[model samples]
Target: MATPSLQDGIDKSGSPIELLWQPNAEPWLPEVVDREFTGWRQEQAAWHEGVALLNLSHHMFDMWIEGPDATRVLADHGVNNFEKFAIGQAKQYVPVTRDGNIVTDGILAREGENKYLLSGIPAAQHWVQYHAEKGGYDVAFETDPSSAFRPGGGDPKLFRYQIQGPLAAELVQRAFGGPLPETKFFHFTAVTLNGRPLRALRHGMAGQAGFEFIGDWEHAAYVHETFLKVGEPLGLVQVGARAYATPSVESGWIPSPVPGIYTDPELADYRAWLPLFGIEGKRPLNGSYFSADIEDYYVSPFELGYGKLIHFGHDFVGRDALLAAKGSETLRKKVTLVLDPFDVRRVIGEDQDPGFVLSYARHRVESGDGLVGVTMQAASIDPVGSVLALSLVDAEHATPGTEVTVVWGEHPGSGAASEADLGFPRIRATVQAAPFNEHARTLYRRDR
Candidate 1:
């Protein structure tokens, strides 16, 4: 018999949004290896000044889609235009509901003529597989679930690592023992490292020049150790999970959003198909932006600042809805919230207050009288001398100097009752450009 999912025993009597905040709920990334190898502060510095290497083989899952109709299946389900997606190129794959609400976004790469790899959150992958099986596509899929899902699932099919910083290219050149191949942003090339085949993708999480090196699991240790040996003089710091999450704020990448797949009548069948223990079923919505209607939580790609990736040239799911929403006057825009330095200190200083704690994840952002938006990720990038958060706000309030208030405490019914009972704390914040780091906006996509 299949093991009952975490949601099997959940009390479904309340609104779906409320059930998400139950104290017993597990985090979306439950098996996150949260630790700082060289310390988080230093790791943050490494990404800016030197080079930072991150081990991404465990936390995120990977799905392989291959067969003659692989590209067709992807083009049908994703909002991105696959017509020009070359084999060596990768793009951010965004899957949406028929109503144009974003389901989830992840990294998709075409490995060969009929082979593709999708890596990131499991929710999007599951959606793709369901369609592939039911749509009668001539495609096959193999998934390497995350460690949290299959504790002893054995060695992963691939080992993933990211190296990013000003010196990243130099380190790669030295490791390859020659000039590094010229690769465009989001494109990759094959190279040999220590006599082993390695595919290096020109990508970066921190919005700096970098490469993502991936290969068979067997070569993981060899590749990591070799890079460390060669990178010793280049100030290479191995980033841990804690620091690994900080870049999203600096790079303007929204890491977590409640997958907008629930409450749509048309998607009832898809919801039924998802395992209760899967990411979609168990992920919680804990921020202060509470709403009885689940639709209030749904977001479109354009609202998330992915308008450039949307193409209406071909018909696809949610194409019509996106077309109508494109350039709409009420469209939400992404921005960075520079939290008031003094107010931030107050929240951290309140540690002496009994049962007081501040949450840095998915806090609610509001204007004077109403909730205008919510923050997706927050971090203290000390090197930048300000606590930063990424937010999607009403266009009118998204100006670089617009002021807003961020609810800093947990919801009243979320997590532990004692912690939840404490009223929400408010912090002053000012809206800024989404890519808070100037280098990310200007130099991020420039080819070396």
Candidate 2:
């Protein structure tokens, strides 16, 4: 097993992923995005043709919560209901402070009936202990180093590599020597690689068919080496953090760290553990990337396009608050808008303006004015030739073809700017409809 590094910094030496994401004094050049993308495409193709693996250590959080009342403990602090989460199924929710600030949202996987694995950051553990004491659940939780891939519980780190595209399964089948048809989405099963028991989950963060493998500290190097050996012929390259940026963006996943969005005096308690949630050292907690003229940057479930998933029939942490504000007047609606690519390119270059590129779709409104929904995560899915933005607006405007205006740019005086001398660059955009790209992802079933 490789010796884990010190806890203060990311595993710079142990994991190549750290090197890939760093722009300077790193293996790849600072201009990697513009120059190396072509080669990255070649590698992506090779890996698709064979097998590709990624050390997901940088992007994961390891927390182990133990107690007789662990399950009950999680139920109290979560903004959403937890009863619906089945064993082995991943449940997502936001942990809120007493003041209603979103601390950080994360996934809880049912590891055992009595115990749960809350993956995201130490924030989950903090909240678990907080409510466990309040609710008298008798649960004790802490960040477990053993939860990491190495022994002695050194640095609680693990790696995740996405095997994607249409050929993902075939490549896995080739390496593991079996049919890959049995795995179900969000379901994980264990397998052995180089004598190490690796856990593979059939969840695709890329929005394509893919799997994520988890293991203890010893398997990282072997896994990385093995993936390269097996994937070379098929076309695989170690995808850097910059290259992975578009995939994360295209996946429409919400980002935790941003200015004027989650950071605020309201979220002071939540901001303490931003590092575990991958948002630390970025900037102020209650600021925003968009300036004053772009509309409110906050979001509710309605604007995040998850209204269908929000059930008010049961009591939840936020049930009373959500119910008190019920009706079209209360709920914000979410929308998917198709943006023009020409506008997005202007935001990417060195000489270009430091600006926001329609991060996520959301609506603007306040209580009692009816639902002025907000948007969540938005992406520019190049495969579909459209800039996709997800927004939450009043339910009345949720329908397709509803025209909405999107504003992008950095506010001049906002905390996002490192120096006071820096000027903000903002832009205005028009958006329309959901499913901005028709090529939604789905699991492949040949028999069906």
Candidate 3:
């Protein structure tokens, strides 16, 4: 398929918010503030040229959860306790169905003592509503469907830029004047750039030590331009969504509208919010498909690599179900698969390409009568000597050295051209532990 493109234009009558797009660039909102100094499209182009700068257009959301029982309200959901989350601290987790199926993965922030910001898939709103109804808590919510990161009211829109990699910090510090000496991972400190107040967070979705800056749209152009001055000097090129998504997969972060293993009413609500949240659309982008039947899409927490994070101490959604099934019934397990180097090379049609093979939800041809379990996310051509993938497999299939077939290429030939065809590659592989790229990620952030 040809590269998707949308032109930048102003929407004066439809909504007060203004948007800009280039015929050749990925669709963006709030307008491209600075064409010369900082263009998200230019940043995307840099990724193909060796360096990477990702726009992160869909992975983010802006929302607010309010009401007196807000804290208790969220607790009733699958979110970990909010009490431990100090003001300005961010927590990430997946919202599970009453049946314990994964509904949506979200990031929550405590903006006020009684109010919180929940951003991720719009399906998260259903979980919030379900909690309010069941817990009888007077809670409310506002979904910022467009993940625009606007700070302060005067600015109609917001723009954020993330600079990552080994030299990301130095380049960012140069743009802000002096150095951003005191920012910690997942923590933010406010600063003024080009006469506009901005918040800089030492956050990296790409698993690299990086910085994300948030500010109003009016000042986006100036802010973007300023970054280029520092970025160009430091050889920091703009990366695209593809480059950034690599780390997310390697880290086992599933995209929104996570499929669940069990069926439930929450599935309908989840479907309603899919388009609003930007997870599933008319044209599917990734390997996962949207299922109207919740049963076909249930995801056990174990399958999501959250088995260790599940604490049964407090009363929360799916608490009883999860606990009751703990001892007796068997729960699904999530495991990683390491592909043969030869097969990996053939799959992407690249000889010794450093880029990893992205995981997809489509059925994978494996070995034996046992079918390949749901492959949630994958990253190939890893620096860690193998192509890795995360999969939710049956109890028998979840084990180290479990001989599994990856199905690299279809029927006859197992080469680059055959792998690129619409059909399966069908390469043989084996099941291992969770987190295929944990080692490499740890190496990247050794300092922090």
Identify the candidate with maximal lDDT: 1
Model 1 clash number: 0
Superposition error at 81 for model 1 (Å) = 0.9
**Clash count, one per candidate:** 0, 41, 23
Model 2 regions lying over 4 Å from their true place: 1-52, 79-84, 96-102, 121-125, 133-136, 144-157, 257-297, 308-315, 345-380, 385-387, 393-405, 414-448
For candidate 1, report its TM-score. 0.92
Q: Which ten residues in a row have the lowest lDDT in candidate 2?
A: 19-28
User: Candidate 2 lDDT, tens digit per residue, 178-272?
Assistant: 65546666766778875778878776544456677777756677876776677666665565444354444444445541222233454444333
**What TM value does model 3 have?**
0.71
The runs of at least 3 residues in candidate 3 whose Cα sits more than 4 Å from the true structure, single-residue gaps closed, are 1-52, 57-59, 130-136, 147-156, 181-184, 256-262, 265-296, 325-329, 344-359, 379-387, 395-402, 408-425, 430-433, 439-448
In model 3, the worst 10-residue window by lDDT is 15-24
TM-score of each: 0.92, 0.68, 0.71
lDDT per residue as tens, model 1, 53-74 = 8888887789999999999888
> Superposing all C-alpha atoms, what RMSD in Å does each candidate have to the true structure?
3.4, 9.0, 9.6
Alpha-carbon lDDT, every model: 0.79, 0.48, 0.55
Candidate 1: deviation at residue 410, Å? 1.3
